[model samples]
Target chain A: MGSLEYRCLKATGVYNVLSEALVEIRDVNFAYGHRPILKGMNLTFPKNKVIAIMGGSGCGKTTLLRLIGGSIKPTSGYVKIGGQIIHELDRAGLYAMRRKMGMLFQFGALFTDMSVYDNVAFQMREHTNLPEEIIHDLVMMKLHAVGLRGTHDLLPAELSGGMARRVALARTVALDPMLILYDEPFAGLDPISLTVVGNLIKRLNDALGATSIVVTHDVQESLKIVDYLYFVADGVIITEGTPDEIKASNKPFVQQFINGEMDGPVPFHYPGGDYQQDLKLKSIERVKNNKRKVTERYFGLDRRQKKK
Target chain B: MMAALTKNFVGLGRRVMNSLWRIGIGARFLSLILLNSGISFSRFHLTVKELFFSGVMSLIIILVAGMFVGMVLGLQGYETLKRYGSESALGSLVALSLVRELGPVLAALLFASRAGSAMTAEIGLMKATEQISAMEMMAINPIARVVAPRFWAGVFAVPLLAAMFSVMGVFGGYLVGVVLIGVDEGSFWSQMQSNVDFQHDVLNGVFKSCVFGVVVTAIALFEGYDAPPTAEGVSGATTRTVVESSLAILILDFILTALMI
Candidate 1:
């Protein structure tokens, strides 16, 4: 029927690539002082999808969230959110941009002195000129979504660990941000709370049509809800795919991390010389250390213990 | 011996470098407090809460210390002035010492141990808990929201407390010097009135206390802001706040006395 148009398309030898990403991180490098944390890290999160960034602890997952939120500038490259570069923006511009982004820090990080109601109402009151009646209803609704409306007047310290995290989750989404970044949202919760939080994350992302990046070490729980997975180690993305592919992959790091293997690309012990040789050296050092401790000790306080 | 000497030199150099770095960061922290000081007025509720904690809570200790110190001064001055055949000058001695020396310096030292340390510990705990970062993620500035109100409360609270301290001290001195020891009340009042000038003694002490207030609170907040995020780190910050603020108050008192008195 359209023979001439089909021939013209085939002659171009081109194919369609991924659709546009909602948040793009291109060649981002981050470091604290001179020590590198993330090196040449690149990622893209699609609109209206939940993605998991899985890695060992101290693998710079929280650092990624900080980079996206413009809390810290990348050492090398750029992070672009909704077509705007984050680190390049001025303070006012950055804040204006962050209004569309929400983050749930590890350990809940609730305002310790505020009541549950006030915590949830904080964003609305600060960003909008809403009347008190409207703010109260909105705060109640958010708390209700997290099943904590009954605890409205409770201080953060009064709430249990799971309840506090749930309240924190409600506050993070009070503005219906375009993107939500959660750092270890399920680390300290019980089984029921973990599943509830996981489901809430997925359900809220879908309900708000918001992109989500969950930086966590909970592989199985994250695999249950995330649309895609990126497993990072030693400051680089080793592999990424759909949950099914990651579950079935044979890559060394992937297999080791997913199955909870003791040893793989990530070693269990600290790096050093051979074990037997180190043991011999360690014994000699132990004798020397004991002699030094007695000489350095004062009133039952060892210098080393005092340093600690 | 040379190696030990070299090691000592290196340690000294490192400490000097670290001190310089602390001073640089402290300057920036003070500038940030000044920049956000306007927000303290607008955020009146938080400032009032901070005042209750940092100001009202310090009052009991300040009052007790003031009263006791005043009684001691009254007794000591009475004995010494009596020997010089000018027992009436006891009021001048007590009033001048209380206004020009003891009230400002002692109140500030007490404040550093109480309110300043508490401020550092509270802010450092917030940082350790990631509450500061969470606020930033919500597009709120921590400097304005967290540090400003506390800074303003301390700066306003310290001078008021010093004035109260001096007043209570003078009252206590009168109780011991006149009512108990049988010094003539008329000479006591008249001598104090003649000797203690408002501008030179009282106002200058107020100015000294105000400056000490700023430096003490600044050290507190700066240490808190700069502390590493850990329990031990917060504890260390609290200790540093007390020590540094106390030292700063004493040094500032000396300099102000030389300049103003």
Candidate 2:
């Protein structure tokens, strides 16, 4: 019974014991040119919790991570991290803030030119005046934590997909950041590797006592590890809860997403005119022409005959 | 008919506006590179690595092309001067042509195709792969760490490459004229020394190369940094770097030659 939990229970009439939020994204709106990506979104990422932002692809998940990183400013509203509005920070202030943050971009995004040891040691070498000996030990420790103690000498291209992702993970937590952002960390991994990565992420967050925002659509894996889940669709938070609450949720979007159902809120087919009407028009045109050979040719049905 | 004509005019206006907008963005990008160039100087190894890629790697093509061009100039100039019975002036003719105009322009055009396109593709692919965004997240300024070093390397490398090209061209001319064609070696050396003004011709050529270096590298870097993050976008940007750099170099050469002459 923390005081914050008691206050939350009293305010919302729900027994939600969330720790204080490390990141507070308030009424944020963002767009690329005329295409709106996120619209009027409000979310909180509690300190030291592995919070998963689950969404379909292109549903503003990565954009939310970028907003948190202050790589791009919101169109309207503020994103506050550690009580400071990120977009308002000056260059030095912003960089100082970013020092406390680590982000694992999708596909590793490891510097192709550097070896795994150099990649993991990059931030430490750049930001610290520590001796090479200390940096070497630290890099090895990070790699060991990710179960990749032996792959330090390998280039990113030399490693398998799973190995590369683990190396990237090691690199991400090298600075022992207060906040870690994972963009599709489970993407394109084998099931075994996926489980290994999920466990590593949980372990790292716990070991470092860091807040993690994992933007992913892998429902089952996310359910297995996350402290809370925020399901996003159409640029807004459609539903949010703990893993239990998310599992029991009756929200149609949540149900569709968790069950991996097609043809629900997100349609199976692209939006277009009536299929029946289109077929009818095509049939009429076919009849008017009264050319079976031409129809077959137009429809590629004559390709086999032509090949013969 | 009037509607079509109006549409054409509107499209033309739109294109003009787009070009102007891009030019403005390019100017801003150049300023950002200049402002963030402190790291490029402080960390000289990064620029040196780029110099190897964009400069040292380009030596083969520059040397071979320079030799061929000089050989052609030797043959052509010898023939023309023979008609005027001033065949001894062959050295002056080849040296003037290379030192004044052909050296900087041809070297820059080759460098644009060779190194400028590579810079664009490398940076563009980096963007497409999210390396730039990753660098930003790590509190690293990509402009300072990546682009500035590359930009400085190009600026330094281009003039040096051009000088080498001119020197190689002279050697090729000597090989063809004095050695192959039996021209008087003493007369060739004397005439070249007497006619080629170090202050006017050589310095102007170096100035032209420096300007071309700036133009080519700036265009390449700007195109890469501004490229949309996609495979198609990177390919398109690489093509635009070569095309735009070539055009900029040629136009600047004309302007510089006009001013110098």
Candidate 3:
């Protein structure tokens, strides 16, 4: 862990700021109807750097990613990529913004209908006038980058989960995007696959000089590659720190989450109209007169327990 | 206690309102899908083959099913009307019933059930798996890239399919009326054709089918796009798209007939 922390620190320092930051989200708020999902969220991504957004489920990490990616508009505030504002753009503008960015979905999200070659060639066919042979070679080159050469005819369903994700990653970067957004890249993967994906992400970022924003629940793997880190909860960014700083963060919620504790600042049970029932149960349990039955029923203690 | 119950009721109402509002957002997203689809027309040539395939190929099934439907309707109508000794009215009955109303409505409903459900499920799975978001990140317009092909495919396909259905249905009626029921083949077709104006009723039916196609495709795509990121959510969206789109088609057909007639 110490060596890994030192390496990450050294890597963070080596990230070139000259490549230009592709996306900068500032003080954004999002809501699913009346329920707030993100509150005054702010983030910036320098080009060619791999940043990780880590949080528990429903923490608006994905929401932040969507806002930057221009899939969803922020209810308040704005996201700017270079000089252009995302929310001010129409569909074409958004599409233009999106073209510069590539995203890797958790399950790979490869079109099950299309083969690997077609999947990688989707954007090329859509946006470019490249000849068929050139497109084919480009797809093969991308597949080769992900170590998936010669599997161009295979459908998404035919591949293993890890392989499918790799294919998706290959397809994503096939456009040679300037930015990459990875939503839970390491989630639901075995250790070997996780490292493979992690290494691939790092390699893609290095090779393409593309900025990456990874949203993940896998803290350790995410920390291994991410230069900058954002830890979010309750629809708001609670803290932003370097990987080592996040590991050393004493913030209560972050601590509780990282340590995998059941009881902490984050409540397990929802506080609802059941407060009366809770109070009633507490009162009943507090009554010493009910000890014999309470011990036998609630605690599941046998009659020999009193003797002990 | 009554006040608490009232508050709970109010809360429930608010929650319901919130849900409805979210659905409206989904609808708006679908409209955005339409706008994006319109933008996709700039790249229409590439999609022309798919449009032709999804349009021309799917017509076969509708044709076969529609012929049987017309035959069945003719057979059943003939049996019922013959008892009243008004067998001559069969031409008007079948023509009015099919060309004016049942032909387009039934075809739209069938198409919605089969193609609409599959589209909803496919896109719902994509949404649940965050593929839509992935497309957005790659600066690929999912509406342009995914939904537009389907939208235009359905838009162009449904009407053609409806026309084929009408033709096959008339032929099926001819087969039953002339061959099985001993009505002269030429006279049966002539009577049916003479009574039904292709421009007025059939064209109107085609128009309504076009509307139905849009409605079905919109509903399916909207439900799929708005689905929660869960297996159950995907399934629910698929089911809702099929049910709601079918119902919407029926309702629209009735309204259109009432207005057009």
Candidate 4:
């Protein structure tokens, strides 16, 4: 079969797989005090699909995650999870709604005082009557899924960044939430951890049949893991498609972002000089510098050296 | 200079009014947060520990401070009354002073400065780091889950501590009067017991501490809830919670004393 037919078949196969509109962000606009962050934002994640939202820093990606997760109410719009209006719910209603969703914070956000087992079992103990023995089994199963069962008794501070995120992921899935929200899941991770988390995200999505919405800055890794994608910049979503389509888009913002370039339609907001002056100064420096430094300055090649 | 001072006075008055308004708003928010926080066993345990630490653990310091305050009151009262040849009344004066004034007010002020600021900072950090948000996403109510235990704990713990302070202060006066100054212990104790009535003083002191406890915990939790979403915001919240709660405790002490007396 041709690629188009294969793609069509794959897309249809996912429709009704988990079979619900698990999360819907409709005409949402949010503000931090008087500063507007997200305006007229609209998005949807159907059940059983992994959707990645990629953007630069301060692009309102994480804010969108907070809005959908019901951590903050939008100033002028509404978010619905499982077709229920989240913002309108009373305290009890809101708490009940929140129980259906899980979140993996960018910083892992584990309770520093609790052990990994306690952290994962927190929601179960809070909202359910499950015996401690059963809770332990479920927590271990979730930990084993993330390959961190060996560290189940460790405190969050004892774990490295990667391991913390794994523990956080395990905790996020502890309740077997119908949906999961991942905020900057792969940012700052080493290549190995990135791949590990990426694969694990996919694995969890498949095994638990949980829909996921990932807010990230790692384009290549996100594209690999997500089934659908949205690209955001300057507090608004500019374009959205499958990973192949996003990569193939000729839009200047996407192009400049994906290619990691300086001279493009997206102008640099240099601290003390105009774009032309900055570009000229940078170009001369690039020519005189070593190829390694040049590549590092433009393409993130120095990351390897810094890691070593 | 006159014009500037007048303007400044008016500004200060308005600021005080605004502060009171915000405190009211904070109390409302605290209740809403508590209402939203669903009941859970672990959260209840955490709250109990927090209350015990904030309230009970500080009893020794409160008692020591109260004793010193009582001795100072007796010494000063004796000096003042000596001129009028009314030194014999020192027993009644010291008892009334401690049970009616020094005990609850000082203890509450101390609690606000110490525990109030710490609670505010803890909650502020939780907000800045999105841990509070994480709790919400996990179907946990941040206010009820976190603040209510501390609130009720303060409500219950502060009065008990204040009672301890009052008892210590009276004994402190007794130490100076009967043991140090050679006043007859029996006469001093009997006179104090007669002069200090429950309706007039002891119950009033407890009432004041209960109010003070509510105010301190409410102010700290309010500052925490209103903390800005950054590290600096947490620091600012801690400072404001401490300063404002202390001031509020003193001012409310005056009001409660006026109403009760």
Q: lDDT: which candidate is best?
A: 2
* Tens digits of lDDT, candidate 2, B1-261: 999999999999999999999999999999999999998888899999999999999999999999989998888889899999998998888899998899999999999999999999999989988899889989999999999999999999888988988888888888889899988998998999999999999999999999999989999999999999988899999999999998898889889999999
Most DockQ-accurate candidate: 2
Q: In angstroms, what RMSD does candidate 4 have relative to the true structure?
A: 10.1
Q: Give the lDDT ranking, best first.
A: 2, 1, 4, 3
Worst 10 residues of 3 chain B by lDDT: B46-55
Lowest lDDT 10-residue stretch of candidate 1 chain A: A1-10
DockQ of each: 0.67, 0.79, 0.60, 0.62
Per-residue CA lDDT of model 2 for A15-79, tens digit only, reads: 43445779989899999999999999988887888999999988999999999999899999999
Candidate 3: Cα lDDT at A36: 93
As for candidate 1, its clashing pairs are none
Give per-residue CA lDDT, model 1, range A173-224, as digits (tens).
9999999999999999999999989999999899999999999999999989
Off by over 4 Å in 2: A1-7, A10-18, A33-36, A277-283, A289-308
Kindly report the docking quality category of candidate 3.
Answer: medium
DockQ-best of 2 and 3: 2
lDDT of 4 by residue, B128-209 (tens): 8778888978877777777777777777777887878877887788788667876667767777878889887888888998
lDDT of 3 by residue, A1-308 (tens): 23355346436864334335577777888899999998888776776688888888878887887777777888989999877998899977887877887888878888777898898998898789999999988999999999999788899888988888899999889889888889888877888989999999999999998888899988888878888887888877787777788888899988887888887888887668788685797788667557777678976785667579
The Cα local distance difference test for each model comes to 0.89, 0.91, 0.80, 0.83
The top-ranked prediction according to TM-score is: 2
Question: For model 3, what is the error of residue B192's alpha carbon versus the real structure, in angstroms, after optimal superposition?
Answer: 3.2
